[model samples]
Target: MTGENVNDTTGDMLRVEDLSVEFRTANGVTRVVDSIDFAVPRGGALGIVGESGSGKSMTSLAIMGLLPKGGTATGSIRFDGKDLLSERESAMRRIRGDRIAMIFQDPLSSLNPYYTVGVQIAEAYRSHRSGVSARAAKKVAVEAMDRVHIHDAARRADHYPHQFSGGMRQRIMIAMALSMEPDLIIADEPTTALDVTVQAQILALLAEIRRDTGAGLILITHDLAVVSEVADRIVVMRGGHLVEKGSVEDVFSDPQHEYTRRLLDAVPRIDDEIGELRTTAIPVVAEEEKR
Candidate 1:
């Protein structure tokens, strides 16, 4: 986590202001994102939530400077006071994988089955800092695995992507992201492919990492239940536009908009729903007795 490494996970991180991305399609021009503004403080977590096609992923990819071809991005992404949108490709190379890192949802697609997991994680750390030996890099990979709560770090390090389960592969992806210790981590639906319990574990790992390194975190997910446990604040997007933004409690307990209300209503609460059923059943029993 040396300051020079860009993986220091320190300092005020990313600020995205008035960000927009548009694509020229055969039909016409489509504005996928429009003037979205959000700032991730030095040590905080922000969750971006919306249904599919809300442009949450594109916003993060824009921040990472990884937008696909034919998409024109406007506005500014300022990270550590450096203008990301205007930065040269060479300068962006330094920041893209080092200062700011990302973890995608599908590890199967991200990690190469041919390469060993340890090699991939080490390459990420080695890419930023020079003169690092393979042994040291491998140790960092193992330690990252341990940090993420992966059992048998050394054994798991040697395993290929196909060897590990879905949850394990996702952990391996997370290990790679944290191995470099980036200052800001943008996780795009990191747990989307995992089961409920595994998703909880991954979120907990992310919470632990943010606490340990004090890095700004932008967790992109449509699952409000997942974000509720970890995010300090939440941003809601709809139809490529900003819909609602507020603290978790504010949005959950006192949603100010109809869309937010519907989103919350869509979440299935086991205890509350069961209690309602039981309470209604008691009235049914009483009515039967009266009959």
Candidate 2:
């Protein structure tokens, strides 16, 4: 597939071209993410789907400049016409939680146990905006919690993260991300630790937030069904290489690559006729822009 795009800037929020990530080890240099290309358009959502160790998370980390100590990324990662790969660490720090926020897989590990939830959220807000008093920051934190539909947000703000349930903790993480009013959000397995019902709720919340803020979204996950309704486009990866990329409808209905067809077959369906699983590739018509 081609990796070209239009010159217009209507929805070109994040563009990743020929991106590759490598790690140096005692054995030798190992490449975790091969040369890959994709883009998340303005106000649009893109999902990266594959099994474990497929480099989906690594791709997200590369874009955020949060790769492991030994990992290094090559190629271009442009956000709003600025190449993040070329920016200094200090400059990247300014952009990380301010212009581009992230929602991690687990909130418990990400949140601090020593501080109150409200204080943590307030600190994240005040760090980006200077000359903000504690009272105002706390007010912002409470409002953010309320926006996420947290019950008694003012009271819960004073409580520790351990006091809340897993679902509520995730909402708190979302509140922290919303406090920054970022232009793009990279959510890595946001609903992994939650139950099925909670997973649906979190996904719905993410969709609503995207609708309200018009922020570009990059959802990194291993489940194909998890991102089916949330993402506008889908990119299938295998062994660090992009096996198929297309609109969500196109990829789900008619996968072009053999690897992609295999993934679809692995998903359990309720309406399936009790028979053997098919592994044949379906016809896929390539669109003009294969972002």
Candidate 3:
């Protein structure tokens, strides 16, 4: 919403410096995201990996200006050259779906039950692009669905969210995000609750989309394996603190933090001779626990 062109590809697409999120309650102030810093280069993918309550999702919400009641975010969230933390809600509304789109973990909860998937996607597009005709917007929706590899997208667009399987529903979410052609996409736990095969497919689709569209991606998840497959860099967080940050290969091969090492250890492995695949899981650390 600043007069600056968000589409400028000169520098990092996003940069967060000393970002902190706090909540004020009857009890007192509690900090959930504490002085964390990271960046996503233009057209690059960054994975924020941490356990539940690590503030990964909260950080994303803070950037989107969707923080819940009593929550406050301080410090810098720069998108292109604009400081989002200082922007008014009105300005953020204009920038959110247009320059920055977010995909949540639960597609069913995000999508409306009564509306057709096409209608939902078209509405999202129209919300950001004023004066766009309904027919044109619908066409964009179909195109987006197809872009995400939804077969027979034109026909599938007419179906309700309930009609689609879990994987298909997630694709609809991605299509909605893609319809706007946002500059940055913040996906929070996008692969959660999906099967291994579908998870791999979705990750591949995300990688393909980034490669094709050159849109910067921030994937927030607990699975190191998922990030290893899709993200170029990884940010490891624990108890609201950044424990480690480096390339995916570096972090996977030689994790600097003990917590990170434990997380990598928790990732399930496959034994070729045994022909068995193990389940993948992340260790849950309590809020008060010190790593």
TM-score of each: 0.87, 0.89, 0.90
lDDT of 1 by residue, 1-291 (tens): 322332233554677899988877666667888889887777678999877677899999898888888877899899889889998888888887787888998999988878899888988789887999999999999999998888899888888899988888888888888887787889999887777778788899888888787677899987777779789889988777788898898999999988777777766662244211122111111001111
Runs in model 1 lying further than 4 Å from the true structure: 1-12, 269-291
**Model 2 C-alpha lDDT per residue in residues 1-291, reported as the tens digit of each score:** 111221224767899999998887766677778889998887778999877677888899999899999989999999989999999999899999999999988999989999999999999999999999999999999999998889999999999999999999999999999999888889998887787678789889888788777777888876677778699899998777888999899998999988887777766651252211233323332212122
Off by over 4 Å in 2: 1-9, 269-291
**lDDT tens digits, residue span 1-291, model 3:** 332332344788799999988887665677788889998888879999887778898899999999999989999999888999999999999889898999998999999999999999999999899999999999999999999999999999999999998899999999999998888899999987687778889999998888788788999987777898889899998778899999998999999988788778767652121211123334444233122
lDDT of each: 0.80, 0.84, 0.86
| Ranked candidates, highest lDDT first | 3, 2, 1
Shift in Å, residue 99, candidate 3: 0.8
Model 2 clash number: 1
- lDDT for 22 (candidate 3): 84
